[model samples]
Target: MSGAEVAGLIAAIAFLIIACAIALIAIRIGGVTREIKDTVAEVNKSLDAINAEVGPLTHEVEALLTKSNTLLNDVNGKVAAIDPVFTAIGELGESVSDLNTSTRNLASKVTNGAKESGKVAVAAKVSKKALSLLKKKPADQEAVTNGK
Candidate 1:
């Protein structure tokens, strides 16, 4: 072939090789961009799921706070309600103590009266025995005097 024609054929082959290399680089870049997009989509999906779960958790925390307040109120109300009962119990205790003291005094008085009655009965029995012995002796003396 002619020198000019041979040079033109070589140049065309070099240009085709460079075009193929550039096309391969563009394909690789497109694949990388697609992977990055997929990764971003997955992250967004995970974030959405976490947000959905947090909704219920937030409500539960609020409910717990409400229940705690209600329990505190109930405790306060019950304490207020029992105040009068406690006062009444104190009064009842005082009355019972007074009753016990009165009972103790009455028992002591009864015991003393019983002891006095016993002493009187013993004294009367002794007098009766002495009188009987004196009467028997007198009868015996008269009998002896008449015989002599």
Candidate 2:
């Protein structure tokens, strides 16, 4: 064969090898794209499932919050209603303390008055005895002797 024809044949074989390498790279890239597409579809499906399940859970949470608020309000209202009773009890305690003080004062005055009255009674009796000793009569003695 001629040298020029041999050289042409070698060049054609090298071009074919380079084209096959490019084709192999394109095939690998296509395969990787398909895997990525599949993964994205699976993620979308999982997100849809989660969204479907979350709807009822959201409503239940809202309802629970509403009930909790109502219960809290009721407890607060009851506490407010009973507050006056505690205030009245405090006032009653103060009144009892005042009554005890007044009672103590009255008892002290009565004891002092009783002691003074006892002293007055003793002085009056002693004065009556002295007056009778000063008023004795001799005429009563003579009358009694004549009558006997």
Candidate 3:
């Protein structure tokens, strides 16, 4: 073969090799871009699912808070409603204590009065018996004086 034709053949082979290398690089880049796009889509999908789930969960938490507040209010209302009853019960207890004290004092006074009255009755009976004996003594003296 001639020298010029041999040189041309070598140049064509080098160009073909360079073109194949560039084509391989482009194909690899396309595959990498496709993988990146797929990963991004998956991440977005997961975020959407989380948002969907959190919406209901947040609502449920709010509902629970509302229910707790309502229960607390109801308990407060019931306590307020019975406040007068508790006050009345306290007043009644105080009155009963006072009554018990008065009754105890009255009973003690009555017991003391009865004891004093019993002593007076015994003294009156003794006086009556002494008077009767004195009256009989006078009659006996008169009988002796008459010599009967």
Model 2: per-residue lDDT, tens digit, 37-117? 999999999999999999999999999999999999999999999999999999999999999999999989977886878
Model 2: how large is the Cα RMSD against the reference? Answer: 15.4
> What TM-score should be assigned to candidate 1?
0.44
Better candidate number, 1 or 2, judged by lDDT: 1
Off by over 4 Å in 1: 1-47, 119-148
> Which one wins on TM-score?
2
lDDT of candidate 1 over 29-82, digit per residue (tens): 999999999999999999999999999999999999999999999999999999
lDDT of 1 at 72: 99
lDDT of each: 0.92, 0.91, 0.92
RMSD of every candidate to native, in Å, equals 15.5, 15.4, 15.7
- As a TM-score, model 3 comes out at 0.49
Better of 2 and 3 by TM-score: 2
- Counting clashing residue pairs in each candidate, in order, gives 0, 0, 0
The lDDT of model 3 is 0.92
Task: For candidate 3, write residues 1-148 as lDDT tens digits.
Answer: 8999999999999999999999999999999999999999999999999999999999999999999999999999999999999999999999999999999999899778868788657767898976765677777767855876
Off by over 4 Å in 2: 1-21, 93-148
- CA error at residue 143 for candidate 3, angstroms: 51
